[model samples]
Target chain A: MEIITSSKAMQERALQLKKQGYSIGFAPTMGFLHEGHLKLVTQSLQENDVSVMSIFVNPLQFGPNEDFEAYPRDVERDKKLAENAGVNILFLPERTEIYPNEPSFEINVKNRTGVLCGRSRPGHFNGVATILIKLFNIILPDHVYFGMKDAQQVAVVDSLIKDFNFPIELIPVETEREEDGLARSSRNVYLSDEERSQAPHLYKGLQKGSEAIKKGEVNPSSVIHIIENYIKTNTNGKIDYIEILSFPNLDTLEQIHGKIIIALAVKFSKARLIDNIILEIHS
Target chain B: MEIITSSKAMQERALQLKKQGYSIGFAPTMGFLHEGHLKLVTQSLQENDVSVMSIFVNPLQFGPNEDFEAYPRDVERDKKLAENAGVNILFLPERTEIYPNEPSFEINVKNRTGVLCGRSRPGHFNGVATILIKLFNIILPDHVYFGMKDAQQVAVVDSLIKDFNFPIELIPVETEREEDGLARSSRNVYLSDEERSQAPHLYKGLQKGSEAIKKGEVNPSSVIHIIENYIKTNTNGKIDYIEILSFPNLDTLEQIHGKIIIALAVKFSKARLIDNIILEIHS
Candidate 1:
């Protein structure tokens, strides 16, 4: 596989490959390869003539107090994992390569960024949106893969593509999970031995909430209480927020109708883990 | 020449043409074609295998109280002019076609939008930036043309292309003007006969400023005063603003040691006219 570190080189290579009639599939990520990221790479490889993986631990997406400096990075391990997943090209741009200077304009995400993890991490989605746009312009991929694990991000990207009329298609993959039902995440390394065991309860609470909604719990508050109580009683963790809102839009829903997402973030001793489940309500 | 009114059909046509190895050159404009718009179209035709023109009087660029409804539009005339200029495809998407829903995200231009016409008209460049991005995504042109008559816009677009790393090249064509030096503009139609006679002074002031700077005037304020005074005394027009700043960045300049732009706007009885000249300074 070819490894590209320069943004100009990546763009030029993309254009040449495109001219040769290749349908490029792109998977953009921060380094430290996990099962979830590998799943996206695997899908890209299956769907396109060429699969390109980009590993950028974007500084713009991290707030001043966030874990930008300590974000796990293993370029060597990521390179092997990506090649094993059948990636044709590996784009590893430095911060300067991505941003030659401080950007004069920003892609401000005005909607769907105020809920879930976005509430706690301000300017995070703006950074994500901006970097992805830059990547899209550089890659010119036929299809871009995004995991539903970052479901809010997926929603924001959906609005971006629709609003901006990007030619590329967005393929959202399902969240990969552990054997114990905990959603697979790189942050799983941040958990202590006790926190690791309690991580499974986060998903359990979401499952219980899903079961209640399926069993005719219509009021949003009553359903939220059941899930909140599950996490509070079963896990030694603090509930950051447990929210039930219209899927993707995150708009307030008075009743169980249309699509809805039950999402929550839990703060353990060493890590903050988030999980969610989407449901279709007809009643 | 093919005329496409549907945005989807236009995008699909552009893609098919591109896949057939045709290089597209795009010239986006508001209709009521003037010499300036024709110059951009002419350049696009000369540069690429296919020249595509889009005539959209974007409401997003006009303020709520501005001349959106009264903005001059002549599609029949514009169609003839574009074909005469060798345009292959003409995209004429209506406001509803371009914007099916109100955009959830806006491309706010924080840098160059605060000066010249942008100083008086807020959210104007943001609208221009937003619409151009959409058009670029749809057209996917290899090169896009813009007339430098609106110099600040050229600068804003410069930053946008660089910041976003758009694969398309920006070709800024020189401002096309009449023999009397009044820049060709559709708004020129709004000027009364008497007001039209006084309009040439706007470009004259730009010339006077350029001459003064070339004759060793290092102070920006002195050059600005020379132009502002000339416009105020020679024409029965109200001076909107006369200012000098670094080219593109629009940053405050303490001394004339680099590329600088002397730009001005004068509001006549029925129309507002703007002009500028870029100067390179030494010592």
Candidate 2:
């Protein structure tokens, strides 16, 4: 695998590949690759002639109190995993390479927020949108992949691509879960042993929530209460929020009558984990 | 020339051409054809396999009191001129098409914006950056052209392209002038005959300021005073501002030592005119 550390070199390579008629599929990650991130890479490999993966732990996306400083980094392991997965280019740009100075311009995300994880982390999507713009311009991929475990991020990416007219297709892969149904995430490394044992209940709570919505319990508050009860009984982690809103748009529903998502965030001893399930509704 | 109003169709067409290994050169303008605008189109034609021109009088850039509604536009004349100059695509998207609704996202320009036209028109570069982000993504051009009549705009775009890592090359063409020294602008149409004659003095004043700096006068205020005095004496228009600042970065200089710009804006009775000259200063 070719490792690129310079933004200019990466862009030149992407542009050259583009001129030569090779389709590139990109998966951007924040190092510390897990099975879920590797899945995106493997899928991109299947879809395109060239598969490019980027690992930049962007500080722009993290809030003042969030995990910018403490975010996991195992670059050696990440590089080996990326090489084993057959990534054509593994972009590991230094912080200065990505942001030599404070950014002079920024993209403010104004939609598909106000619910779920977005509600808890202000400026999170804005930072994500900004970094993705820089990456999309640099990578110039034909298609980009995202794991639906970070479903709000996927929705933000959808809006960024559509609204800005980025000529790349988005491939949203389903969430990769553990045997006990815990959504796989790098932040999972921060979980204490006891918290790790209880983490599976977050997904189970979401499943119960989905099941209630699938059946006739239609009031959003009632459905939220059912899941809240499930997690409260099974786990010691604090529920940050459990919201039911229209899918992708994340708009509030008077009564759920279209595609909707039941999503939640829980703050355990040291890590915050989020998960969601999307379902379509019949009139 | 082929004209497209749909953003999606234009992107698809640009992408297809790109896949076929064609280089596209783009020039974005507000309508009202003139020799200056045609210069950009003809230059793009020379530089690339295809030339794409867009006429969008972006409302986002205009302040509430600025002349957005009254911005001069002549589609028929522009179409004929662009066709005569051999443009391959003329994208004329409606305001609603460019902005289907109030934008849920935006690019806020934080630098090179506290001087010249940017100082008077806040959020101007922000809007320009937002729209250009859309256009660059949609057109997928190899090179984009801009006239130096709006030098600050050229500077802003240069930063936008480099900072965002946009793959497109920016070709900053020298300001096209008439038999007289007046910078060609669509806004010149709003000038009364007297104002039309006085507008050339704006350029001439910038010339005098440059000549003084070419000699030993290195103080920014003195150079600005010289230009301001010339404009105040020669024209009926109100001298809005005349500033001498470091080039491109638009930073204030204690004493001009490197590349510098003598920029001015004059508000005529009915029209506002702007002009500038960039100079390389030693010691």
Candidate 3:
């Protein structure tokens, strides 16, 4: 596998691949490869002649108070994991390379990103959209893989690609989980043992909400209340938000008509955890 | 020459050209097909194997009070002019196709766009940056051309392309002017016959500033005073802005070090006109 550190080098390599008629697939990540990241790489490899996995700990995506400094990173281990997952290229750009000076430009997706994670962390989605656009241009990937764990991110990126007419396909991979149903996240490492034990409650709460919707609950407020009450009783996790939004658009639903995404975010003593499930109404 | 009105058809044609080893050159314009736009297209034909020109009177770039509804457009005339200039494909996507809904996304450049015309028309650069990105993606040109009359716009776009790492090269064509020295623009149609006669004073003011800089005058206040006084005396035009700035960054210059751009804007009774000239100093 080829390893490149500069944007020019990556584009030159991508040009050569294009000359050979190879379809390129990209999986952009913030290093610290978990089972979740490997799943995306695996999916990318299956879809294209060449798979490129970029490990950039983007400083723009983190807020002033967020865990930018404390975010997990292990380059050697990530390289080994990506190689094993059949990635053809490992692009590890330095912070200066990704952002030469402070960025003077921004890409913002409205409405879909204004709720959920976007509410608490302002400018987060703008940062995501900006870096993603830069990466897409540098790599010229035919398809890009994103994890479903970042449901709002997927929606925002979808709208960005659509509105900008970026010539890339977006493929969303399902959330990778532990045996006990805790969603896999690099931040999960921050949890204490007791917090880890209680972390599964977030997913359990989502499952309960999905089950309630499966049982013909059409009202969004009632579903949100049930999920909120479940998390309050089962764990000491602080609720950030419990929202029942329409799938894809993420608009707040007055009545669940077609498909709805029930998303939740909770903060334990040690870490913040998020998870979601999509529900469809048959009638 | 092939004329395509749908974006999908144009992209497909561009991709086919790419596969067959053709270097794409693009010229994006708001279609009245003036001599200025033809100069850009003519340069594209000389430098590239295929030349694609897009004629889109982007509504996003016009302020609510600006002349969006009365903006001149003659498609049949534009087609003939493009063919005569040896353009290979003419892209004219409909307004609805380009803006399917109220655009939720905005691409904005900072620092550079806050002066001159941008001060009067809020959100104009945001709209320009957004539509240019869309056109760049759809056309996938090897080199894109813009007139240097919009010097601030060229600077902002140059910064954006570099910041985003777009693969296309930028070619800044010299401003095309009429015999009396008025820079050709679609908005020139808005000028009454008497107002049209006074339009050349904008260019005359730019020439006076450029000549002062050429004769070793580096004081910005002196340079601005000369141009403002010329415009104030020559025509009954309202001076919108007249400032001597560092060439590409558009920052206020304490002393002329290397390159300086002298820019001016004047509002006549019926139209707004802008012009500029770049002066390079050598040791």
- Residues B44-151 of candidate 3: C-alpha lDDT, one tens digit per residue: 989999999999999999999988888888999999999998889999999877888777787777758887777878889888998998899889999999999999
Tens-digit per-residue lDDT, A108-218, candidate 3: 767687788989789899899899989999999999999999899999888888888887899999999998899999999999888888888888989998888888888
Model 3 pairs in collision: none
Query: Where is model 2 chain A poorest over a 10-residue stretch in terms of lDDT?
Result: A209-218
Give per-residue CA lDDT, model 1, range B1-283, as digits (tens): 8999988898899888888899999999998998898899888888899999999999999999888998988899889988888889999998899999878786778888778888999989999999988999999999999988889989988888889999889999998999999999889999998888888989999899889888888888898889888888888889989988899788777777688888888887767788888878876
lDDT by residue for model 2 (A1-283), tens? 9999999999999989988999999999998999899999999999999999999999999999999999999999999999999899999999999888788887788888877777899999888988899999999999999999888998999988888889989999999999999999999999999899999999889889878877877799998999999999999989999988887888987787688888899998889999998999895
Which ten-residue region of model 3 chain B has the weakest summed lDDT? B102-111
Over A37-94, each residue of candidate 1 has an lDDT whose tens digit, in order, gives 9999889888999999999999999999878888888899999998888899999998
Position A150, candidate 3: lDDT: 89
Q: How much lDDT does each candidate structure score?
A: 0.89, 0.90, 0.88
Which ranking of candidates, highest lDDT first? 2, 1, 3
Ranking by DockQ, best first?
1, 2, 3
Span of ten consecutive residues with least summed lDDT in model 1 chain B: B248-257
Candidate 1 CAPRI-style tier = high
Candidate 2 has an lDDT of 0.90
